[model samples]
Target: MRRRIHAFSAVLALLFVAVFWISTVVSELFLSAAAVAQVKLAIAYALLGFVPVMMLTGASGFALGGKGRHPLLLAKRRRMSFIVANGLFVLAPAAVFLSIRAQAGSFDSVFYSVQALELAAGAANLGLIGLNIRDGIRLGRRRI
Candidate 1:
C-alpha cells in the first residue's frame, strides 16, 4: 500500500510539472489582454491544485524512506527538497509577480528577464524531480 501511494504521488507530481510547463509556454506565447487574463486564471488554479499534490508527494516519499539510510533514498530526498524550495521561494512568487505586472499592463525588459529566470528555475525543478522519480523507482526495485 505504501509503495502504491508513493507511486501515485510521484506520478501526480510529474503530471503537475508537465502541466505547469505547458501553461508557462502557452502563457508566454499569448500576451494579449484577454489571453493574459485567461492564462493568469489558469495559473492561479494550477497553484491552488499544486499545493496539496506536492504535500502528498513529499509525505509519501518520507513515509517510504522511513529513516532508512539508502543512498538512493537520500538523493531522492535531496531532489525533493530542491523542488519544494525552488517552487516555494522562486516559481510561485515569480508567477504571482508576473501576473500582477501583466494585469497592470507592464511588460518591460525586466519582466521578460524575470520570466526567463522563472522558466529556468521551473525547468530545473522538473529535471530534478524526474531524477528523483528515477531514483525512487530504483530504490523500489532494490537496484540502488
Candidate 2:
C-alpha cells in the first residue's frame, strides 16, 4: 500500500513538472493571447494536481515515521512551512506575472493571473487538508 502510494506520488510529481514546463515554454516562446490562455490553464491544472500529491505525501509521512511524535505539533510545523513556501513560490510569481501582464494591456494576462491565483489558493487548501489528515491520524492513535 505504501509502495503504491509512493508510485502515485511520483507520477503526480512528474505530471506537475510537465505542466509547469509546458507553461514555461508557452509563456517564454509565445506572447500571444491564445498562448497566454493555454499557460493559464496549465497553471490551474498544476495547482489542481497538487491536491492528491499532497495527500499522498502526507499519508506517506504518517505511515512511515509519525509513530511517536505529537501529530498536532508536527502537522503545525509542516503546514506553516507549506504556507510560507507557497506564498514565496506561487503567490509571489503570480503577482509579478499579473503586474507585467497588466502593464502590457493584454486581457488574457488578467485571466492568466487569475489562474495563477487559483494555484496558490489550491496549494493552501491542500496544506490544510494535510493538517487535517495528520490530526486525524494522531487522534486515532490516542489512548483516550
Top candidate by lDDT: 1
lDDT of 1 by residue, 1-144 (tens): 878887887788778777777776786786566676567556766888887888888998887788988988888878888899999998888878877877777778877887798889988988998898888878888933
**After aligning candidate 1 to the native by TM-score, how far in Å is the CA of 37 from where it should be?**
3.7
The TM-scores of all predictions, comma-separated, are 0.88, 0.45
What candidate 2 gets wrong by more than 4 Å, as runs, is 67-84, 87-144
- Any idea what lDDT model 1 has? 0.80
- Candidate RMSDs in order: 2.0, 8.8
Lowest-sum lDDT 10-residue window in model 1: 31-40
Candidate 2 lDDT, tens digit per residue, 1-144?
764574456356445544554455457467765566556555645555565675565566456544546657466446646654664476546644644564455666564556557455545645464454546456546731
Give candidate 1 misplaced runs (Cα > 4 Å).
30-33
